[model samples]
Target: MDGLDVLADETALLLASVESLDIEDLAHPSNLPDWTRGHVLAHIAGNAEGLGRRARSMSDAVPRSMYESLESRSGDIAWRSRRTVAQHAQALASTQADFAYDLAGIPADRAGDDMEIRLGLMVRIGDLPLLRLQEICVHHADLGVSTYDWSNWPPALVAWMLPRITASFAAREGFPVGWVEVEGARISVGPDPTTGVSGGATEVVAWLVGRAPGSGLAVTGVDAVPVPPAWL
Candidate 1:
């Protein structure tokens, strides 16, 4: 499937997975620092709303900073998260439904275009919403919700992202770890291959995102250079 199709699948699956959780489950902490499951869930809802607004207003010169104003949005998210999980599920259902349609309505060419739109200070829009899609998938893991991993992430994306992940780490100061290479579905660091942690792609993707790398990567691979976040 193409990027947008993958996007739709990612969105639907995330919504379904989160919806299955108990609302009380939201209060549980996630891998993301200082963020409860509720916070992560709210973040997804908030993200859908934010992206939905942007996708619809692509014509407008809305500064991404508007969406970056997460604090203003968090009050509502936190408040709603207090409701029963079913309630949150409804909210998630509503938002994802709208976002699915909003994302779907985007012209195939425009969505996959090389043009980069600033979604935040650290984010840009390019290449079939790779970053956006990454956020949803990674956060799904962050929320302690299991659906898919880098194994499910597109291979082309993995190859394109591996160099970027390794190189970005090299450019950073105290990020941790080392060089990385994505050979087909596997990732290699220096001479050694991946060990049990999530595959190199997942590990690299998670490592770059400040979360635990999943499987298939050797955590000991660091011989030179700090590990870098897998930035798109």
Candidate 2:
């Protein structure tokens, strides 16, 4: 199966996760530094809408140049996050519905057709599915969905994200300090990143994302930062 299949599966999983959130849980802080469960759902749903829109535009051969500006993307993110949590949930459902209905309108085989996309670069339409997966997988983990074991994760995603996550940890708040322990390797993100793997990857990733090594990370070492409840 291709990334589209992965996206579809991930979407369904995301939808289920959103559905399962009780208001109490939604109000609870997620593993992220400053987001609640509600915020996580909203962010995930918003990303789905954004990505689905990008994919549909590509299928229709429409030129999208708005994302060329990082400022523009930031503005959009801010706008989406501003919506009420309920509205954000509805937006997620609506966006998913639209994608499901519209997928049938475009020939599935045509998704692989390459054309000038984002910033006029040529990429196979099929690659968008992977992009969608990137969104889902990262956000899913951002919400602390540990039911899906690391071993069950898509290796493609792990390989692609290891460096990015490391970079994020290194540049976070522009500190670029501290040591990161993941899996069996340790990457010293502060002084050096060659620390390689150490203990549990999930623990390290949670810590890097502003949580503790266990459960929902509530503290950071050396400098304790009270993660705001809005980091979902």
Candidate 3:
């Protein structure tokens, strides 16, 4: 399926998972450090609202910041998370529906138009669908609520995101120069292959995003797989 279709499917799945949580479940710790499940729920809802606004702005040929500032973003999540689990579920569902509404009228041909997105980054309008999908899939796993893990990811997404994230890491100053072999795809990211990590695409993306312990990958020219420098 295309990225938009994938996002629609994932959003439905995530909402179902959110709906299953009880009030007490929101108080439990999530995989994200120092954040409870409440924080995750709040952030997801806020993200939908912000992204929907951006989509609307794009369609109008106007500019909009996803968040006013970093502090405002955190404050919004904290404030919105004070509600009960059912309230959070309602917020998620409503905001996601708003996002769908904002994007519905965007012509497929116009999706390729370059536009400034979050953090002043320029990307094709088509890329926003994949960005939303990435957020949903990654954060769903980050909720750490059940059997959700890298293995649950769509292999197509793993393939598509692995190179993009690794390239982001490579562009960072002081990031280790290396080659990554993901399910037989050799992705060389720097001047030379000074180090290497080989694994399934799911495992590699998980590692890149700080979701894995690197136990599943084969390493070469290092004692163990080096922790990836943060890219997001």
Badly placed stretches (over 4 Å) of model 1 are 60-68, 104-128, 146-178, 184-199, 213-216, 219-232
Deviating ranges (above 4 Å) for candidate 2: 65-90, 100-124, 145-152, 159-195, 198-232
lDDT of 1 by residue, 98-197 (tens): 7656556555545434433344233333343554565677677777656554356565555555655655545555444333433444333332342212
In model 2, what lDDT does residue 111 have?
A: 68
Q: Can you write out model 3's per-residue Cα lDDT over 113-226, one digit (the tens) per residue?
A: 887667756657777777777778888888887856667877667766887787777776664547888767777764557678888788888988898877889987778878
| Candidate number of the best lDDT | 3
Q: How well does each candidate superpose onto the true structure, as a TM-score? A: 0.68, 0.55, 0.93
Q: Mark the 10 consecutive residues where model 1 has the least summed lDDT.
A: 189-198
Against the unseen true structure, what C-alpha lDDT does each candidate score?
0.58, 0.56, 0.79
Q: How close is candidate 2 to the true structure, as a TM-score?
A: 0.55
User: Compared with the true structure, what per-residue lDDT tens digits does model 2 show for residues 1-232?
Assistant: 2566766777777666666665566667766667765666666665555555666675686754525476766556555655654565677778766755545455678866874445544446655556556666666666665564333446665554555567654654433334545554456555543322234555444344444434432223544433212112
Question: Per-residue error at 11 for model 2, in Å?
Answer: 2.2
Each candidate's root-mean-square deviation in Å? 5.2, 6.9, 1.7
Error of 3 at 2 (Å): 3.0
* Candidate order (lDDT): 3, 1, 2
